[model samples]
Target: MAPPELHPAVLQSVALTVRPTSGAPLALQTKVLDLEPQPDGSTTLVVAPPPGLDPREHHFDATLAWTYPLGRMECTVRTRPGRRAYGDVWLVCANAPATRLQERAYFRARLTVPVLLTWTEATEETEETEETEEQPEPVELHGVVVDLSEGGLLATVPSRPPALGTRVEATVRVDGENLTQPATVVRHVAFASGGHGVAVAFAEPRRHGDRLRAVVFAVERRRRSRT
Candidate 1:
């Protein structure tokens, strides 16, 4: 039986991992270029080939894996066996169902590191008429990172963590280097060990790519050493 057509929005945002049935994997990442819906509920997709990918090998049956709003999806795309276009190549594929999306794509390394968290309360400010009063300092909480990831992290705090969705600044020491960034509390759970588990997502994702990559490399190195 034929599968349902994937949503156009999902097709636009998802990145595809294209693997031909008979060939080596492409080097560069491939993203969706365009999607053309058909009256019969089928859709034609234009996928961008990675740089260094040979244009002559465009024709063949290949498996495409991508993540959409719903979850991860896989489908088979077949290109005509002939000369294909130079820029974006067109392929016909069957729509498939998506599974549950994972919370983290990158490997989460288990480690312990001290961290300082700070945030200000909205109701803490006071009105001053005669003399200008200085704003109260942000409340600081000490915590320890339980696991780390490029996107976010899970930590443990001695006290109850800040309410979910609360934005806070974290100064964490990674490999003797102090890295500070703003993050939002996504999950808070009290553990049996008397500490609270807090999950935070980085607010400014663009600025910490280098630090995250370094941490990932360090974690992988450490894992290799143990193995």
Candidate 2:
């Protein structure tokens, strides 16, 4: 059977793995900014590049994975530097067709709760800071959890979202228990309600993976039972 055609709407978020000529594979979660259709029926994906990686530096063998309605899908493609689209975003052309992958390990459940995010922003080095050796203070932002899963959760904040690949500590209360996990900023999205949504992947998912799975499963069961 021929591979299915992927639509841009369905390709909201994706996990990108890029292998450099010399170095460890860089894995990141990012959102698709735009899609360009080609004459040969292929599509070029404009996406957020991993932090500190210059697309102009080298070519890469990349694997793109995303969750589809039926299941998860992925494809391998060769990527070369394309024109810079906007701030911190670049284009990568997928030169191959996608293949179906196994079903997702965990289903995301809609859950609304309060979340506290803590992260630090880089500051310019100064003479005083160099002498003191003090680190920058961590900034705290409060948001609401829109969905939950074993892998990560989506939350929205009033202010501009943090930069991608930032390490953050997220704390959420579930069932009277406060769960804190170290997570990475994966993607940023805007909502119609005038706030920004940030998607974060748990850096140490195994620490609270079981608890999150249980909560998600319970939510799923309750929703199904009502219908």
Candidate 3:
């Protein structure tokens, strides 16, 4: 159902998808029982246990989404044990606008900046007697940074991309200064547009986290000043 201009108080109910901590995906239909907007910018959500659901299994995470006049709003909720009602179900009071993507420990900024990637390849030894692997020369890859966070970055690569679990060193220039760090390829996807999307997580986020956070803050402030 399409609701009017999105607001915390006006949100009555929402479609909820629950994912158990055991990594089992919920395949049943579910909905918020009674959505009550609470004070202090949080909403109280009540959920009833569906068929074959254990009442004691309230410690799980869920994602809820609903459409509004402006657009669709989605948020991740951490379920907790609520009052002993409705067969001892779970309830949550959260801010609807505080989505999972926006609630990161570190802020992220979208950008179209050039990034340099370097990694080494391991070559198998030709001799059957020698079981040791040879270390090949380091190779360089180029990509455009699409999103930047203190912990990781998402880039679009034009050529063959590295496999997941590959570790690489990356460098990005921000505001005339360069930030370099070691990162691992945690995720990768090939788009129909003929480019690959690579997600790299910093091996030591604390190393260059200050610089990354400063850059993000500066970008945010500059944009806010313009608006």
Candidate 4:
């Protein structure tokens, strides 16, 4: 699930490894249900086989290559039309899987490559006063990254949730292999994991800012999970 603020594109992909173990009269079809983006920049995708496809009649399957970063994605498929289904998913690189990896066959080692790119673009800044946190830590981890379309990103964590008037530094990671920078923290919200979501605005994004931004995007992408 995603908050209303995060709107992401719907990535489409196919699910291979399905054999006529199914007798489905008609061929199987696949589509991406939706993609959910979180405030942290991570994303989750939902998919399933098309309706009107019979389950017992045919063992149907297909593989899908969705939008960039999420290349070579696969899942076990089943469709009950108006009911629910369970799928086994495996994330692989576009060049991976010389042959479609089978589902449930109890295979050897498998690799799941992430489509998330490590975008760098960050700035450097510091926060002296302890404004926010469930329990303030001595040091804070923060950074900034450019969004997919020149969109900017800000990330920060404070010792505790600060009052609305508090001001702090923001950090941006530089792009092109270099990383790290400085910025300002604007607001803080207490997160469930004893972390605060510190809203920030960078003072200067040029000069290695892009590198940090790219790294943060990579970090954010790694945090995404399919609950």
Candidate 5:
């Protein structure tokens, strides 16, 4: 079956692997410029080809992988001779359909990092007047992140986990940088190891998403290199 049409708004980043007929594969990170299929059943993928790509090597087997809201997906396509669409952009035609890969949208890395989680509990207002807004008592919890991802994180806390759907502010140290973001608690589980595991989904900020994905991808690349 043909894959669903990808709206430009949902396209964030793509990982491309190009394999020449007689050379080793080369991996690149790129973004999708367009993906409209022609009447002849061939799909043309307009992408921003990364640096170090040989303009001469156009006919090759390439695999494009990307993540969406539902899950991750990938497809292999045979490239025809590609042409430069504009400055630093290229249009490559694909003669095949995309294969949807059933996996989580974001790549999760098993990382143990210190994180500070804070939330507020609503308290009764001392003043009965409607103009007075009820003050919430702020609560803080210190936890160690068991795993990290672009979407959310799994953290182990010593005390009782926050209730589901609770909004929280988290400050986590990643790659020597402190990232503060708001998240919603999605799950809570009691661990046999004597702590509660809380799963929270991040309210992804555009700028912070890129930085967090960079850290996750860097760690993944390092792990791949060592294997």
Candidate 6:
């Protein structure tokens, strides 16, 4: 079936393994189809996956990049009826600043480290590759977020330490595919072990504020997958 058209604010991208069992075409680049902002700071981005997906695979993952100016803050965005995205983060700063949206989207590409992210779904344990961690890692942290700010996070990572000044990147993984980015670790301290914590940083913060917001959004996503 032909993919339906989306609004202007929505964006889409696709990545498939070469040598796929189904022998479908190689991966193709994705583009944003439509976009629109919500009154409550959430976004309405409509996206569609690539064509010719494997019938058996039944699973496809895509990366979404939403960039709004400084004044226009947004934190949440939903794509369709089946998928609802939460965790709205905004980079709070004065003036929009001179920057390009493409450059800002770069922050979404920092998941090279390979992390093993685990979350609970339907009372059953689910796991996804957060990064490329070769060795087994243990760190089950979960909690509700108090607020979402620009380039910083306030959450409850019971066993996570505040990775202050240590770069914290975002790694989006699904069924084993991974994409990552290098974020400047700004804050990673414990509010109270087994209670709540805070980790604040940016993806490539040296460049400017453009990336600061990216981390904000990425972390918000991490929070959602947990809940």
RMSD of each: 13.7, 11.4, 13.2, 15.0, 14.6, 21.2
> Candidate 5 has which clashing residue pairs, if any?
none
Q: How well is each residue in 23-122 modelled by candidate 2, as lDDT tens digits?
A: 8988877777777767876667777666677856544578888764334668876555556636656566665666655465656777788888999886
lDDT per residue as tens, model 5, 109-163: 6567899999975435533426466555689999988667788887878899778
- What is the C-alpha lDDT profile of model 1 across 68-93, one tens digit per residue? 32124456555432224455464546
lDDT (Cα) of model 3: 0.64
When summed lDDT is taken over every stretch of 10 residues in candidate 5, the lowest stretch is 1-10
Best by lDDT: 2
Instruction: Write down the worst ten-residue block by lDDT for model 2.
Output: 1-10
Tell me the TM-score of each prediction against the true structure. 0.49, 0.55, 0.53, 0.25, 0.50, 0.24
- Compared with the true structure, what per-residue lDDT tens digits does model 4 show for residues 1-227? 22212111244444433444536434434555554344654333354544544423323243333222111223333322222345532222122222323232111121111111122222232234343623333344433221211112323233443343333333332332332334344434322233334434334556444454455456546656422
Task: Please give the lDDT score at residue 123 for candidate 3.
Answer: 42
Q: Which regions of candidate 6 deviate over 4 angstroms? A: 1-144, 171-181, 188-194, 205-227
Stretches > 4 Å off in candidate 3: 1-100, 126-134, 225-227
Best-fitting candidate, measured by TM-score? 2
Q: Give every collision pair in model 1.
A: none
Provide the global lDDT of candidate 2 against the true structure: 0.72
Q: Considering TM-score, where higher is better, how would the candidates rank from best to worst?
A: 2, 3, 5, 1, 4, 6
lDDT of 1 at 196: 65
Runs in model 5 deviating more than 4 A are 1-102, 123-134, 205-207
lDDT of 3 by residue, 1-227 (tens): 21111222222345556777667767444455655555553556666555687755654467656532113357666567555544565675443444323655667765667888888754444323353654456789898886687888877787876777888998888777778889888766433233567778888889989888888778778868999
> Which lDDT values do the candidates have, in the order given?
0.61, 0.72, 0.64, 0.33, 0.68, 0.34
RMSD of candidate 3 to true structure, Å: 13.2
